[model samples]
Target: MFDKNHPHLFGRLITFIFAFWLIIGIALFSLNDTPAEINQAKAQTINNVGAYFWAGNVKDLGGGFIKTGETLLEGLGSSIIRISMSPRFRIDYNLGGGCISNFSLETLAKGPDLNPILTNPSFSTIIITAYDGTSFSDCETKNYLYPDLYTPEITAAIEQEYKALAQYLGTIKGKTFIILNWEGDNDIYCGTAYGATANSCPNYQKHIEGFTKWINARTKGIKSAGVGNVYSGVEFNIVRYLKNAGLPSILYDVIPNVAADYFSYSSYESINELYSGDNGTKLLSDITTAKSAISAGGGNNSNFIIGEYGFETLGREDSKNKLETVTNLLHSRGVRYAIVWNLLDSGGGFGLYDSNAVLTPSGKYVCSLYQGSACFIIQSPSSTPTPAITQTPKPTTTTVPTNNPCAPTSGFASSCIEDGTKIITVAPPNISNSNLNLTISIDIPANKNSVIWPTGYYWSATLKNWAPFTLQGNNYPGSSWLVNSASTTLSVPYSNLQPGINYIVTWDYIWDGSKWLGPPCSTLTNSLCWRLETFIRP
Candidate 1:
């Protein structure tokens, strides 16, 4: 009787232990599968989505009145309300010269007689991108001796206009982001004084400098005016032309010098680079580079925003996919705000909706992305192949000479790899003075059909992130170049390097024909592409 009871008790004990272990295993699996980071990112993104209106439903229809009910802005808000059942849309109120000065705050507050898009309860924030009539010609001059000739009145007028806009927007109902000048860089091209010798024109340079100063003053004035909930800054255009001309850093500095609230830029490259699948990476690099330049210029403002981005509906059937890809990439990178170019499909073709206020495929995709819906489907294009434009070419593979002074101590091996399976190495790892010219080399697996566009970045201790290196002589070595080999060398002036601090240099991303792929790790992954070397200046 004792032996039989012992056997039964032992079996019961085993069964209890098995059940306990099973429950514990299930709990562990659930914990591991919890998408904590993803959920957090989504929550953050919901707050960052905003809109930009060019020629859209937001424009004043016929009869000298804006039809609020039939407008694109109203349509967008309504759609969002229907989908989310919440009134939390962020509207980027884009105003050209006329709208900025002519629109009355009281009238705007009330909205159009019929629809009233601006004052709709759905809006949680209002970002104003105001552009005055001051063109590039107004800012740049032909004679260096008269650098101030073309800009004083124009600058003053702009300041006054901005003051008025700020004062009015201050009384608005929600958060406000004010940009005094939208795409001010275009003024450079409009200056007749520069003629063919644009860069050589001292007047042009002086005007740019003066304009930057004026922007700073305007920003201060807006803040001093006691404008409630208004964050003011200036916006510039970020394109390969400006970057190749070595203008990104110079322009970025204008924001912080004047103590502007944030830095902003607009890029259409995503639309152009969509076929190559490098749009997202290119944009990421551009933003990182801009941040780096801003920090190096002693400007503390790090908040970056995309003022405008859009693609045409004509000829390109894959525009929707491209928009989704770019939007997702921006969200993933933690961009504060990104405004799509226009609300209506005007003749320029970047509009998200038609004149009738119907949502296009691209518009729908953008709305879905903004609304946190998993409905976006990546569709293939039904047009001619877009030519691959390589910004940085791969270098010819050659043996690293033992006598080279800039060679890394660890030698060039496949380590500290980032996106595109690329490797980076910095030479003369130890820095003693500010005059050293640091050499950077990058290597990628050789692919015959792939072209390379390499963007260089350095870590900024002050800003606590990596910034784009200000390349010397305005040489854009990263522009599209055919890659014959897998390695390339980049030179950096040591004087430009931040002294008494460690700097890690690496590539922002690589274009591999199909898409732009960044380093496997990003700011979110607890790792950034690769750490080539930590140059500590003694």
Candidate 2:
């Protein structure tokens, strides 16, 4: 209530005003720093699904098939799922339903023990048939002892085996990957042991056809997933090696045709000899080629999985060293998945943990790389028609790049932008966030039209959404967030802004949401990088 003319009153008023401004200034500075968004080009590309990583192969313990299902998703995040539907066929004999049998793992290796994995929630994605003969294949080699495959005894057995696999998998109530595979049937040392010459080899097409038919019967038809079952039977390439073993044309010639049916291959080398470990050479190099060659030979529906591929350190001290190199190679070559091939030493020296139950150094080594984008199936648009012939991507975990969280080894590496984050920037020469607010710029890409800045991300536990504050746009569109229009710039109010904590990407462009969507790059017209994520801090 002081007089208006008082000198002291004026001073007090000025001081009060300054103090208020100072408080606000401090709060504004402390609002927290948000990371700069990554500048990206206009996105118009569409993709199908998330890429899968791999870890696979295990021997059965007293755990049975259901236990194996729990173990598959539990032990290896993206590794091979245990397949146990094949039955001893005898023409017209249908297996499964009431049929039950037992099996055990003879080849034990070091790795994450499935005891805990079996309890994981993701186990729902696993299909468990009664575990049976997954041991190293035993081929009959007895000369002049070949039986006609079309006969009921054999045909029925094969069909029953397929039916069992299909029936068990058909019961899956979650996101499961079916493994329609067979191993003991492949040409192995047992073929020679039984004295069956190559010329007298039994019919290979019948067995594979039966398997495919069973899968189709279960899945409704030859779908992309069913056709892509090459990885399940990856270890049976024993056929390829048979030619060098002096087998007959009937045996060798059938390889390229049916080898991919189960994603076939076989390897008994220790990790040490596998990689040589000389300079930087890996042991799995040759093995990678064998698998790739087979996958390419098979048709589109051919799946590429390595159901069995591992070595024992007991034989070679360097066995563990070759693991990384081989894993890296497989990932790089687009062999979508693989299993470590072990359980109780039920069969070999490959168990990640000791029979006594402890993680081996090699077991730990393979597990470390099992996570993340090991094999990214990158699509390269060919000049072909509707369904583009995209090459399968290879391993993308080697040599991680700086500042990127979704590390890319090769193929299409991941973006640094998190999901649901908004962008804020201007247009013209400043189409990129690099030049903001001012109008001085040039060289705008054709993809970009109307450049609108993003309001950025703010957190509110109550909202639970990324940015939980009021929004308002001037030239942009998003104001209260709820108000969204593609054509306008968006302005979102933030409760706070922290730098490097949010996985945000800020790219500049000129797009009116409705029509123009680009910062046109000649090399990226039809291509798109829709989203990305990074390791930022909160």
Candidate 3:
């Protein structure tokens, strides 16, 4: 009531209004600064992230299959539930029941029943590994030598039980990834000492045959049962060097025969290699080799799955950084999915979370990548004004040479030698002009099981390295540059060819879903060059 119209009161009121508006304006600016979405492409990148979880049973909270009311299982589920609530994160449920004996097939069959929570709409996909307690090395011994344990009748019974489990899984209407047997190679290689006696030792070939039979039977049973919305595959440990080089029991022999929708391999090399300062080059090479083998075996259409990968460094920060680096590497390589090895650190050191369901450092980093925040967001000045969006300019097309001189040379080294019928030809090897036009033609074998595509490699004399050529052609849909035809001819132009220096142009082919197969043109192989050339002035 004091001086309502007084000059001093009016001035004070005006001052109060100005200060209030200024505070509100500053808050609005702060709110706007709270990390805007960087781009739409990054937002979609987090969709398929997943992890593995195993909750202990009642008797042992740290080990044992899931039993209702088990505190560990409940805690594990709670963690999964929390992760599921996070956008773009899913849980990979390892069916512990499979680890039990065949006598408990029915109990194992109930494993899916225990995951009712996973069926919720929030969970977009479920990846279940149906473990068969029999390890790969034990496959031949248990199924053949030990007749009492797995007789013909008993094997048939086990097949039927797996079929039942598959049928149950198919009933759930969502994208589902099922690994029929996890790490079958381990059973063959790890369970037995190398060079042990025949009876007690691992018969690598026999083990492969037995594993193939088991996989085929299980695959057929699941298919015959009409499992819908399910992608099935068998998981193998990364191929051992000796096993791949000399054994007939390789993945190439097994995968093509079975009707697997995809192939999966577990990679733990990064765990040891990361600390030594290797940034997944070894892991990537392994993956490339595996894909090449699979594709050579005619599993061209099969996608790849990184069934398991994890790391545990000396410090939590180190572990988190490693996780971020490797996960990004996997995603960039066209891997369909990567499930972290374990959700809880079982005291052996790879778990993303502690036993108490709290996220460890690696887990937090993983969670951030999945949520599209820690990896995707770009921090900006809170006070910077938002820029106006502009239309993107259309790319201009460059005209490439249609004719090139190339000739096949015997001196060229290649990891994969060309089959006699499938030849790589480069025309007019010795060239004088700087605008070196090269044409490469590949004769696709009529019985070629895989879709063949053209890929070229050129040796950089100056750089002393072999660099891959950028092919010009219609890319196979959804693939980088792979094609789905019988034969392909590519014209390459090298305008930067150095005079008086020898250069090599190596022709190669990539079978769909695999690495370069016909020739190893890059530094990946030490084989003698198969395509050699020198550009000289006339």
| Whole-model lDDT per candidate | 0.45, 0.32, 0.46
Best of the candidates, TM-score: 3
> What is the full ranking by lDDT, best candidate first?
3, 1, 2
Model 3 spans > 4 angstroms off: 1-44, 55-113, 132-155, 192-200, 243-245, 248-250, 300-302, 372-538
Superior candidate under TM-score, 2 versus 3: 3
lDDT of 1 by residue, 1-538 (tens): 0000111223334334434644676411134432243334445544455556433343333232233222344435422211000011112222223223243323333344312444455555556544333322222232212236336675565456556656655665654545545555654444221112445544455556666666664675577668776676666664355556554323554554667776666665333443332335567666677667666655543466766666653233345544555666666666667777666654455556654444567767666554321122122211211111111111122333334323332212123333334355555544444345556554545542222233445554445444454222111111222232223333444555455544444433345544544334322343323324454443
Winner of 2 and 3 under lDDT:
3
Model 1 lDDT vs. the true structure?
0.45
lDDT of 1 at 182: 55
lDDT for 107 (candidate 1) = 33
Provide the lDDT at 306 for model 2. Answer: 45
**Candidate number of the best lDDT:** 3
